[model samples]
Target: MNFILYAVPFFVVLIVLELIVDRWRGVSNYRLADAINSLSTGVLSTTTGLLTKGVGLVTYAFALKHLAVIELSAESAWVWVFAFVLYDLCYYWLHRMGHERNILWAAHSVHHQSEDYNLSTALRQTSTGFLLSWIFYLPMAVLGVPLLVFVSVAALNLLYQFWVHTRHIPKLGWFEWFFVTPSNHRAHHAQNALYMDRNYGGVFIVWDRLFGTYQEEDDNDPAIFGVTTPLASWNPLWANMQFYAQLWNDARRAESLWDKLRIWFMRTGWRPADVAAKYPMAKPDLSQFRKFEVPLDGRQQLYVALQFGVYVALGSYLMNLADSLPTAALVLGWGAVAFGLFAQGAALENRPWAFRLELLRLALNLPLVWLAPLAGLWPASAVAWVGLLSYSLFSVIGLYCCRNRITRLAS
Candidate 1:
């Protein structure tokens, strides 16, 4: 069972509640573009997970079959409890390595790209994490934890982390010492020197405390969210690929083959001496830091918001039907969704070409409405066709209206 799917409505509810709290407190923690960009990465991650999750599942299953020392029953309550805690311990190392190593950070940095830390940031996940993340939990499989237990505990651990991404909650007195909380987790998200790589635990704070990575949240030195190397664009596709692209370029530029091969495994931010000398990258001064922003008029904002809403609905539909859909349909659906998100991000960034991109996306959907069903995504129905056609028609009209605003902003 996909527990995250069932929890989507609750996540929406909590985000809305956080917005209300933001209003009541008269502090703005959420930006429309930043939040939308964060969610775009999340939606992309979920859609990508449909195709890639089998990597982890298959490998873990193979490990359990070949390497298990004992058979653990999923029916035992103690097994569930033990698996939950143990899964978090494995997560601690994975989370820590994701920060410490270049290759892992290339995948994990998606979650840290948001300049504003909010509930939406929690949803900003890595689409490529399945490639290596499964290795972290092989210990559980070898120790004989049932697959069902491992998956359930993993999901529960993730769900528990959603609420800790907020600034609204203060330090919970004694609870701060044991479990991961809003205060400590905020420190984890900070780019400040004091908080750079601290607080790596997912559920329990004890791992950090035990491993000497713990650092308390200080009132004097507040947290500044985002990475050392900022992801300035709102483009979801670029957000995922930015660091990897940097690494690839650095590798290509290095004079030594060993530097090329080992660059990926080196500590985060480490660069070859030759590459570092030729192409110097400067870290921003935190004291003079400013969040990335692109101005949009009211019409542009509404147009992007409406378009994003349509994709969110489409994304939810894709998630629900993904398992039953054929490979051709999944590929087509994934491509359309991915393109739609990129166009939305372009729109948010006020790119001059955004209007054409959106218009093209809408025009393509006119055929996709008919083609999607034929490709085995859904059964053909008049309602699906008409609903999609109407959506495209109105969206084209909206995109046409926003052309001037996008042009003015881009210029």
Candidate 2:
């Protein structure tokens, strides 16, 4: 069972609840643009996972089949408990290494790009983590933990970590010592010199405590969220690509072949001596750290919000149909989702190109609906066609209506 599928509705409810709580408590933890971008990257990551997850499964199966040192029965409760702990240990290292290595950070940095730390930030995950994350879990397969057991524990570990992303939760004295509570995880998310790269455990804080990576939440030094180098944009696609682009540019500028080759695997944020001297990167002043924001009229914000809601609906439908859809259909669906997110990101940023791209997206949906049934990609239903056409038409009309609002905001 895909536990995340069942958890989606709960995730949505909790996010909405958090927003309401933010209002009731007079604390500002959720920002509209930032939350939308976080969820957009999350949706993109899920869509990408439909294609990439097989790599992890296949590799794990291979390791189990060829290299098992001992056979373990999945029916035992003790085995489940042991596997759960072992998985977190592996996750700790995988997460720690994700922060330590340059190429790995390129993938992991998406989760940290959001300046606001809230429940929405929890969902902002990396689509590219499939590149190397599976390598960390091979030990479980070698120990002969059944695939089902491994998957179940992995889901549990992930679910356990979700609630720790919030700011509303304060430190729990005894509980904080054993588990990765919000306080500890918030410290992990901080860009502060004291907390950066600390607390890598997923569910248990013991690994961090034992390994000397744990840092307590300090009253004097409050947690400041986000990466040292700010993402500085609202584009979800760019959020994923930005770090890789930086690494690529640094590698291209390096004078030596060795520098170019090792730049990717070197410690996170390391630059070649020559590249550092000539093409120096400016560090943000910590005292003056500010969250990224853009001014927009009410209609522009509403339009983006409504469209993102539609994208979420579409994404849920795609995830439901993922296993049954043909590769071509999945590709088309993913392209549409990616384009929608890109357009939404652009619109949020008030980019001039957004309107044209959104217009193109609206126009393209007509043909997609008209031919979806012909290609047998969509179920042949009058209501489905009407729904698609209605959404497309309504979106175009909304964009047309919002033009003046966008112009005024831009002015």
Candidate 3:
């Protein structure tokens, strides 16, 4: 079962509650564009996972079947408890390596690109993590943990992490020493020198403490969220591709063959000597740091928010029927969703072409609604057509109303 799917409503509620807390405290921890971009990456990740998750599941099943040394029963309570603990241990190393290695960081950096640390940041996950993340849990399969137990524990570990992304909660006295909490997890998200690469645990803070990786949240030196090399864009597609694009350019510029090959596996942020000397990248001074922002008028904001809502609703629908959908339908649905998110990001950035692209997307939806059923994207039903037509019509009206406000910003 997809536990995350069931938890979506709760996640939305808590995010709203967090917003309320933010207003009450007069702390601006969330920005509309940043939050939307964070969620855009998250929705993209979920949609992408539908096609990629088989990589991990297939490999784990293969390992469990051909290489298991013992058979563990899923029915035992002790097995569930033990698997949960052991999964955290495996996760610690995966999470650590994701920061320490360049190749892994290429995938993991998506989560850290958000300048603001909030509950939405927790949802900003790596879509490509399935490629290598499964290797960390092979031990569980070899040690005979049942597949059901492994999957359940993994989901539970992830769900437990959602609440820790907030600044509203303080250190919970003695509880801080054992399990992961908001305070310590905040340190993990920090880009500050003192907090960089610390607190890698998912559920238990014990792993970090035991492994000498733990660092207490220092009140004097507060946490600064986001990576040193800022994403600096609201585009969800660019957010995922930013690091890999950098690595690719660096690899192409390197003079030596060994430097080209080794660049990918080197420590995170390590560049070739030649590339470093010629194409220098400067790290921002944290003392003078400012969050990335693009101004949008009220009309534009409402239009973006309404359109984002539509995509979120569609994304949820895609997630629900992902398993049952045909490959062609899934790919088409994902492409449409991805394009919608890209357009929304462009709108947020106040790009000159954003308004036209959005108009095109809305116009295309009319034909897509009718054509989709014929292509096996959805069943031919009046309800689906009417629902989609109404959505497109309303969205077009909103876009039309926001035209002057949106276009003037780019001017």
**Tell me, what's the RMSD of every candidate?**
1.4, 1.3, 1.4
How well is each residue in 213-331 modelled by candidate 2, as lDDT tens digits? Answer: 99998978999899999998988899999999999999999999999999999999999999999998898987999899988778989999999998888788778988888877777
Q: Which stretches of candidate 2 lie over 4 Å from their true place?
A: 374-376, 408-411
Model 3 poorest 10 in a row by lDDT: 401-410
Rank list by TM-score: 1, 2, 3
**Candidate 2 structure, TM-score to reference:** 0.97
lDDT of each: 0.93, 0.91, 0.93
lDDT of 3 by residue, 1-411 (tens): 999999999999999999999999999999999999999999999999888888988999999999999999999999999999999999999999999999999999999999999999999988888889999999999989999999899999999999999999999999999999999999999999999999999999999999999999999999999999999999999998999999999999999999999999999999999999999999999999999999888888878888889889878988999878887777888888899999999999989899889988988888788777876778999998898889888888788778856567769
Query: For every model shown, what is its TM-score relative to the native structure?
Result: 0.98, 0.97, 0.97
Lowest-scoring 10 consecutive residues by lDDT in candidate 1?
Answer: 398-407
Q: Model 2 — which ten-residue stretch has the worst lDDT? A: 370-379
lDDT of 2 at 347: 91
Better of 1 and 3 by TM-score: 1
- Give the clash count for each candidate: 0, 0, 0
Please state the error at residue 243 of candidate 1 in Å: 0.5
**Please, what are the lDDT tens digits per residue for candidate 1 over residues 50-157?**
888889998999999999998899999999998999999999999999999999999999999999999999999988889899999999999899988988899999
Quote model 1's TM-score.
Answer: 0.98
Which residue segments of model 1 deviate by more than 4 Å? Answer: 404-411
